[model samples]
Structure formats: C-alpha cells, structure tokens
Target chain A: MARREVSVLFFLALLCKAIAIRSQPSTIDASFCLSWRLAVETNNELPWRTVPNKCSQYVEDYLIHGQYERDLELIMEQALDYVNGISIVGDGKDAWILDVDDTCISNIYYYKSKNYGCDPYDPAAFRAWAMRGWCTAVPPILKLFNKLIDNEFKVILLTGRDKEILGQVTIDNLHNQGFIGYERLIMRTNIYKGQSAVTYKSNIRKNLEDEGYRIWGNVGDQWSDLQGYSFGNRTFKLPNPMYFVP
Target chain B: MARREVSVLFFLALLCKAIAIRSQPSTIDASFCLSWRLAVETNNELPWRTVPNKCSQYVEDYLIHGQYERDLELIMEQALDYVNGISIVGDGKDAWILDVDDTCISNIYYYKSKNYGCDPYDPAAFRAWAMRGWCTAVPPILKLFNKLIDNEFKVILLTGRDKEILGQVTIDNLHNQGFIGYERLIMRTNIYKGQSAVTYKSNIRKNLEDEGYRIWGNVGDQWSDLQGYSFGNRTFKLPNPMYFVP
Candidate 1:
C-alpha cells in the first residue's frame, strides 16, 4: 500500500482504539458504582466520605428517579408490617427510634447542589442548609411515623444534629412537614460533642432504655444510625448512597 | 350501530382491559422483587421462606446472568482491600473466618433446580446435592481465600454444615477447588444441633477467640453467619438472596 493509505489505516485504527477505551470505563464504572452502593447499603463498605467521583451522575439519577422513592416505599411497607405484628402494650414507653436527617427529613435538595454527595461533606455548608429549615419530609417515613402514632406507639425523633444550633429549626421543620405528635425529639447536646455517630446515638438510645422505654423499631439512612448498642429490636436501613456519617 | 357491531366493540374493550390487567402485575412484581432482594441483603427484611412466588423469574435471572457474580466480585474486592490494610502481627493467631456454603462454594446449580430459591428449601434434596460434592468454587471468594493464605493470615472455614454428613465431602470439595493451605474447618456437630444459626456460629466464633485466634476478618453470605458475639474486627457480607438461615 502507498504511504498515504497506510497513514489513513493507522489513523482509523487509533480512532477505533480510542473509542474502545472511551466506552469501556463507563460500563465498568457503572457496574462498580452499583456494587459500591450495594456494599454501602449492606454495611460491607464503611467510612466512605463522599460518593465515588465516577458515580456522581449515577447517584444523582438514582436519587431523582423513581427507584429511590420505590425503595423508600418498600422499606416503609416492611416497617409498617413489622410494627403491626407487634402487640403494643398500650404503654407510653413503647418507642420507635427514627433518625432525623434522611430518615424523617431529606437533605437531597442541598445535596443536589453538592453533586448528590460527590463533594466532601462540608459541616458549615450543611449546617447552613439545615439552618434554612427547608428540608422536606421523606414521604414514606412520614406515613410510617403517622401510622406508628396511630397505633399508640411513641415516636422518638433521634438525630445527630446539634442541639444548640439546629434545635428550633429542626423542630419547626418537623412540624411543618406534618411530623406531629412525636413523643420526643432528641439531638446531640454539648455533652455528646465530638463523639462518633455510633457512640453518640448509642448513648442516647441507652438513655431511652434506661428511662424504661422499649425501642421496638429503629430506622435510619446510615448504618451508624442503626448499629451500636441499644439498636432496638429491629432496625430498618433506608437507602442513602450520599455520604457516610462516620 | 347493529347489535352484532356493538357486541364486537364490547368484546374488543373487554380484551383490552384483560390485557392491561395481565401486564400490570409483572411490572409491579418486578419492582417489588428487586426491593425485596435489597431488603434481604441489607437485613431489613428477615425470616423469609422462599423467594416470592411472583419473583421466580427475576431471582433466576439475577443468579444466572452475571449480576450476582459481579456483586460477589465487588464484595471480594472490598474484602481484599480491607484485609490488605490490616497489619498482621507476626504471631500465628491472626485469623480470617469464612462461611463455607455460599462464601467458598456456590450452590447455584442446585438452586437452579429449585427455581433460584423460589421453592421451599428441601433439606433431604439439598443434603443429597451436598453429599455428591459437586459444588463449584465461587471464583472471587476463592481468590480472596488464596490471597489471605498468601498474606500469612490463618484462614478458618467455619460453616453451618453438619459434621457427620458433610465433613469429608466439604474438605474434598475445597481441595478440588484449590482452597489449600493453612486453616481449620469447623462444622456443626451434635451439641449445636438445636441452636439457631446465629447461636451456633457465634458459639464457634467464641470458641476460636477463646483459643487465642484473633478474628481480624469474617466473610459470609448469611447475616446469621456474621452476626452475634465475636463477629470479628471487621465483617464482609457477600450477596445471598436465596433462603435465610434464621
């Protein structure tokens, strides 16, 4: 073949190779992101700060799309089914532990601006967002909460939000979102500062148990919220591929 | 219109309605099955018997089509990364606990006949399958296993299999599949017969700890295999959407 022909052939070959390389990582990355999310959900993967850089789009789409809501719905259904099966003693001490962020209320609106947790967690920025008190109720959880109240079970809102800065706003947000009649709203006070989420939440739960309350059900979007001592009789983990609390 | 024409139109409407009704359940069922599997993997839902009757095809496809294996590969990768991070003491007591059935060897072929866990677990048939010792190694897990051995970590095969029935076959199968090198194999014996899987496995783990083995890592498909006392320094849960042990 002539030199020109050979050059053309080499160029075409390079283009094909380039296309192959370009197309490959997306598929591999997509699969890896999926597995990463599952591993995170099942608590196999831990202590992740932010979503994988490659999975930002995937995570964003999952959150905005119908799958996230459907997942939440299924969890709520299961939780309600479990609660219904229990014979509530009709005592005020039968309590349900619910995490505030991503459990009862969602910060997805704020996280949307942060690439759906692709950005590292900024404490000040997140606190600023929370201070706005603009977070909405997670619908399925709101439904479950009301059902628990209707069933005469005490509903406790337990969170890692700072009691000093976020206390009033958190209360206002909950009330605005129809999360009324909760038995208590517990937040991180000064004494629990700097403690890991697992330790802080566990200590609070221990206090509730100490007060003669039976925590029958616990629900949260983070594994840290569900793990540790006094983790309740049954715990439900809602999907949050966003960020790890610890 | 004539009566005959009216009848034809009515029949067509009825046929359309029938088709709509027939098509809707599958879509809903598919979503529910996906959520159900996730819930089971995350330990949100528990004590399930067989795969939901409507989800037979979904479960079968997940098991056979590459997704399940991909999930397994991700877990194995995470486990290896975790294992690599640990600084093993020169002492021979650094141990890795692994559950045998789905973690080391897969029962996919047997489950294929059982509708991918859509059928109720039949102990006699399953034991017969196990006795044949035709199980294949889960490739990712076997890789992790060999890597652990290479790293000088003591690998312990802790399983829920009956010692009297499956001891020799289990050993032969492991050897045939290249699971060689340093280890101990602990299986269920008479004393643990009546106990639940959590109790049984926990007891065995406690025994190993009492013997001065530090369980730096634990990997299992069933939650029961990983829960309870002496769970380990860190635990990795492999994907198992099949039957629940307890």
Candidate 2:
C-alpha cells in the first residue's frame, strides 16, 4: 500500500512538470509580461492559441492568467498612481490624458500581423481599419475609468496613431468604446512629426495645457501613452518581451 | 584675349567649386537650422548628429563668435520663432521657456565626456561647481537668454538638475550667469524618482502645478529635461549625441 501511494505521488509530479513545460515558451521572461497583450495578439503560435492544450496543462491553468494579470495590475497601478498624483490644472489642479488604440478602443486586429495584429502602416489596410469599425473597450480598464469620471475628472485620449487616421474614426472609436468625457483626442501629425517618442507625447502634453484641464490620470499599455508628462518620449512601455517582432 | 579670359574664368570657377565642396559641411541645412537648438539642447545631439555633414560642420563655427555669431543670430531668431510659434504652454500664450546646463552653459566639455565642464557627475566636482565661484556662463546662449530676459513677460528656467544641487552651486551659477527676474526654476526630484528619465522630470512639472504655476515654455538638454512628462518610466534615453559616449 505504501509503494502504491508513492507511485501515485511520482506520477503527479511528472504531470506537473510536463504542464509547466508546455504552457510557456522557454524564452518568455519578466519584461515581456507588460506587453503580453500585444504579444499574444501578434503571435498565433502563442501558448494561448491552443485552448484545450492550455486547459489540460496545469501550468497554463494555474499560472498564465493569474501571473499575467497580477503583473499587469501592479504596473498599471504604479502608472495610475503617477498620473493621478498630478495636480497641474485648474484652481485645484488635474488634467485629462489618454491613449489611442488599445486604451480607447480595440485595435487588436493589428496583432494579426503576427497572426493577431494588423500593421497600421500598410496604407490601404490602415485606411480600411480607419474607415471600418469603432474601437472596442478594453475589459479591465472600464471600471476604473468610470470610477474616476464619477469623481469629476476629465479625460483625454492621446495616441501615437497617425493623425491621418484620426478625426472621425477616433471619435467613433472612442464613443463606441464608451470612453466618454474626453475633452480632446491628441494624435501625431506631419507638422510636429519626429522620431523621438518622448517629444511626440510630452510636447502634446505641453500643448494640452491650453484648455486648463490638467491630466489627472492616464492609462495605456505602451509607456509613451502615459508620458507627455513624465520621463519624456517613451510609449506605454510596461514590458514588451512578447512582441518586439514589429 | 577670349582664350585668356576663358582661362581666367575657368580658374575662378574651379576655385568656386572647390570652396563649395570644402565648405559644404559648415552650411546648416535650412530644415535643421530651425529645430536644431531645441532638439540639441533637449538631448544635445538629436539634431546636430542628424544634420548632414555640411550642417554638422556648421556647429563648430556657431560655437565661436563673429560671422558665426551672425549665423547664430539667425538661428536664435528661428529658435525663438520655433518656441513661440509652436510652443504649447500657458494656454498657448506664454512667451518662452528655457533649459539650463548644456542649453545655457557651453558644457560641450561634459557632453564630450572628456572636458568635465562646470558640473561633472562626480560628487566632489559637482560640489565644487555648486560653490558658485566665478562660474562662466555658456556663451552662445548668453546673448539669447539675456535678450529674452530683457524683453520678458515670463522667462522660466526648467532643468532636470537635481534639487539638492540647487543649493549654493545652482544659486551662484544663476547669479553669475546674469539671470534674474524669472518666474520659476523647474527642477528635478520635486515629484518621484524612478530609474528612468521620464518619471524624474515629470514629477517636477507636477509639483509646479500644485503651486499654481503655469508653464509657458520648456527647454533643456536631455530628453528628460524637456519631454520627461510622457509615460511614467525613464528609458535611460539613448544619449546626448553631442556629448554622450556610451
């Protein structure tokens, strides 16, 4: 009876080890956690693609969602703390700031470029995207945004998406996503266009001071999204280990 | 006589061609002439390094006075226009914003990483500079800063230099540099500290708003100095091309 019990324990350990090996690619590391959304969207071969494989694998069942979500929450919380702590507008201070694409809408199709994301750079395809549908809201962020809005905060959706693709599409997307209460949707243009992501975003922030609505809090996946007010030109940087392919 | 005249003309033409080729590098491209100052001082090298060889050579001439000063006057006028025309500060009505250090001081030495100009990152050296002992002002900008101050509605000196450094060294440096009657000195660390440049400088801007200040202009050398208000993380920016070796 003792030998039988030991054999069962040995089988469970082996099963656990196998599950871990199959759920995550060996190359996946810490930094990639931040950009995982984009990564998974862009990579068809990503472990999540095989639904049954994921569920059957104990590692994916126990690890993927919880670990990924926890890391994301921590970074977002840190970012929100930095944004909300700001008091730089009106008599009491605070301004509206936002990011285009993922923050305000769903452009996950671009991930199809790897199997998930569409490359917005391709003119005709980009135009199709711009002309086609409204952006969808990201799941986790909706509740927080509503909470802030309830507290009397204004919103701004600043994105690195080309100015050419903005205007109506952006407004439609914002409305479709239920990302209301925004005073402006800042986008990149040829006039102020330059390579440095720092200048692109922060310069816009400097300009946004015009309406006297200082950004109270900003949320987005790329580091540059929240910038315009901080370190400089980095985009929603959180970690992007998953998708540097593009 | 026609042959002689042709020979003489030919010789002059060769001289002219040779001069054009040799001096090509010293001629600042019209495009760069406009944005180089802000871009350069913001990161010190973004524009200068990007300048074609012809334009790059022009920097040395501008480094000195005389014909170079004339060239500088033209560029400064353009820089002022760039600042005023496109600047997004103080409800888009503020006059100008300027950065200290490499922007105002001719710290090509520190930039080059060899001369160890007025303020070296070295603790003792920086402490000594903080002594304020007859520190010389950066030359090219002396006339510019003074000119703006004399005509000032508002002249803000925004710098990413640490607050602790603002003590005697910074105060004395400002005094010696002949800067006075400024509304504010935007400094670093008034916000939060992160390993990246974005958060370091953004905090300073946030604190300013808390104090009821409206930033009209922003100027600095490193990207963090001017555009740090972007997303919250500092990217340890690539480098100041003019001085950064690593």
DockQ of every model listed? Answer: 0.22, 0.01
**Candidate 1 residue runs with Cα over 4 Å from true position:** A1-27, B1-29
RMSD of 2: 23.9
In order, the first chain's TM-score in every candidate is: 0.89, 0.59
Model 2 chain B: which ten-residue window has the lowest total lDDT? B230-239
List candidate 2 segments past 4 Å from native.
A1-68, A78-93, A116-127, A193-196, A210-213, A226-246, B1-246
Q: Which fraction of the native contacts appears in each prediction?
A: 0.40, 0.00
| CA RMSD of each candidate after superposition | 8.3, 23.9
Best by DockQ: 1
lDDT of 2: 0.46
- lDDT, model 1, position B163: 95
lDDT of 1 by residue, A122-170 (tens): 9999999999999999999999999999999999999999999999999
| Residue-level error in angstroms, candidate 1, position B80 | 1.3
**Model 1 vs truth, CA RMSD:** 8.3
Q: Report the number of the highest-lDDT candidate.
A: 1
